[model samples]
Target chain A: MAFNILIVDDSKTIRSVIKKTLEIAEIPVGELYEAENGQAGLAVLQENWIDIVFADINMPVMTGIEMIEKMNADNLLEKTPVIIVSTEGSQTRVEELIKKGVRAFIRKPISPETLRNVVNEVMGDYDEGGN
Target chain B: MKEETKDIVYKVCCDVFEHLAFMFGEVLDEDDITSVADTFIKASMSFKGEQQSGIVAIVVPEELSVNLAYEILGLEKSEQIDPDGPEDAVKEVLNTICGRLLPAIFGDSPIFDLTPPETTVISYQEWEELVQGHAYISLEIENNPVLITTSL
Candidate 1:
């Protein structure tokens, strides 16, 4: 089965890389959408049924954290899992993201194996590697 | 002058280079570290945290930049690579690298402040002139030199 996916990042390069990595990993995707910031990501959510959203933490116009908080407040983020894709490496920050109901967090420059593992697990595959 | 700052700078450069190489699958080696070339792709980003405003600069050779553009765009190198279009790419690499480095150096949440990356095409002499007062470290990525200059 294929799933709809949204990628939100301010960097075109990183978005391209993530898309490429997904393709290389052979993740089943029905649609691939991109947004440059949190607001844009929210706009996409209004129109599409996204199974997973990959977002960066910092950006102009809107940030990932703000986006998540807004989505939660508006009740638009229920059931839809968001995974923070950022370079931030702090336990407290990651905990904050977890408290905000993020499904998972992946650091930048993620390997294909890890990327695959995250998506698979979120889709309820329950991969042992992800654990 | 602090050990924390020194460690962060070194790690940032190493991490940024490794990330680029991994993403592009291209070979980046440092050929020369002393002087930059006449043609290069330069990116800059401002860091704002705890009453301090500093800048980070990453400069790569034009050849490498063009190559990276092609790799990024997922097009053949024979295709015309738009030099202007990759400015955002430059900025992004700088932003991520700096964002990660700040906390390591400052031992804080890196403040809620940072600027979008600004990039420009620069000449060797121009870069030399710009580095006069600021502290800098240069790396030879697969023989292609990348100079990182910072003003704190």
Candidate 2:
């Protein structure tokens, strides 16, 4: 089955880059979505069946951490996985994020291989042709 | 800024430019610096931690900003570029640089909160003023001058 993915970042360039990277990595995707901030991300999550979310920590309206907190509070939303794709480098901050229920952490300047690996690790194996 | 800190910032800037933008960068000696451009795109962000709080900024030529956006987006030069693409690209670059830089300077354990990067267009006069007023590092990327400044 194809996975539905949502990307949350304030930078339009970053959102495009992530979308392109996902295509380059050949991840089986269905109904890819984009949001400018965590609030918008939550709105998307509320309206759609997103398999995973890739979000940035620092944003204008709402932060990834805040979004995760809200998700954790919701019984249904907490089940969907979230992976942080940011430039954040502090191990302590990363540990805190993981404890807050983040599924994975991906540093900026992401590569296709890293995206592919993380998706496989989080979503389990899926056929390239969407079998 | 201390010489050691300058060196670290310089190294991190070069690495980020290379990895994030696929652009090669080299530190330019003071004597090697030449003329300033007519305009530049300046991107800046602030970071605060328990032991340290400061701002990191990068200034790039407007022409180079377009190239940066294209390079980062992996777009063909012939394709039409979005008007917001250049500014957004630089902001993201500055954001990533700050994220990597804080840890390099303050160690990985200290948590630093980074503000969302901001960008502005400035004239050559303003660029010269910034260079003269602050201790800034100059880099040569794609044969264009890029400046990095920090205030702690």
Candidate 3:
């Protein structure tokens, strides 16, 4: 079964690349939604169901970490795994995100295999026959 | 701040290009590296450690930058690559490399902070006239040339 996914980043290029990567990787996609920043991402979340979110840590409007913080504070961290896809590779930064309930960290220039692995690992039984 | 800073930067370039080439399914050549800053993509990131501030600027070619982005984002050629992206693809490459490399150079678990990457396009004319004698490292990965310039 395909899953609904949301991608959040300020870069249209990055977003387009991700969408294409998912398609190329043959990840099942029911419906794909995109937001340029955290606020828009949250709005999309409220409006539709998203199984996972691939986000960049650094953004103009609202950062990925800030968004996760808000989500956790509001008890909305459940039901979706937000994997941080970014260039920041500091260990401290990674640990901080882990504490906030982030599923995993995939640094920039991410690979197809890594993306697939993370999605599958996080979604687990929900994917219903892994894509 | 020593004369070896150039060597350090060069080593960093070699190490990073080798790793990136392996990751991108290609091995880079030294001949492909170009020092001409005009065709470079300018990227800057700030690092703070021990009350000392370091800024890393990576100047890369547009095509190479796009290719790196493709490798990073895993996109096909059909997808258009934008030179203007917030992720600062090339800059992020420099930032991550430096962030990892600097500590090893410092030989300590120093608290280093990184800022987001910022990038821009640079023309050859401007590069020759303005960026005079700037320190940069050039490399060829699978015959693809990559350049990096830093201001610390």
Report, for every candidate in turn, its global Cα lDDT versus the true structure: 0.73, 0.90, 0.68
Q: List ranges where model 1 is wrong by over 4 Å.
A: A125-131, B1-4, B22-36, B49-53, B70-85, B106-113
Computed on C-alpha atoms, the DockQ of candidate 3 is: 0.22
lDDT tens digits by residue: candidate 1, A18-61: 89888888898899999999999999999998888999987889
Best by lDDT: 2
Question: lDDT tens string, model 3, A1-131?
Answer: 78888999876766776787687777899999999888888888888878888888776678888888877766554546788987664677788888888888887556678788887787884455342
- Root mean square deviation (Cα) for candidate 1: 4.6
Please tell me which model should have the higher lDDT, number 1 or number 2. Answer: 2
- Higher-ranked by TM-score: 2 or 3: 2
The estimated TM-scores of all candidates read 0.81, 0.96, 0.74
Off by over 4 Å in 2: A125-131
Residue pairs in clash, model 3: A109-B72, B27-B142, B28-B140, B28-B141, B28-B142, B29-B140, B41-B60
Worst 10 residues of 1 chain A by lDDT: A122-131
User: DockQ, in order, for the candidates?
Assistant: 0.30, 0.87, 0.22
lDDT of 3 by residue, B1-152 (tens): 35476567667666665454343313233343344334667777777777567777766666667677776555577977564642356765775666656654664445565666677778876444333454555555544455555565
Which candidate comes out best when scored by TM-score? 2
lDDT of 1 at B50: 57
User: Candidate 2's residue-wise lDDT over A8-102, tens digit each?
Assistant: 99999999999999999999999999999999999999999899899999999899999999999998798688999999999999999999988
Error of 3 at B123 (Å): 3.0
Model 3 has an lDDT value of 0.68
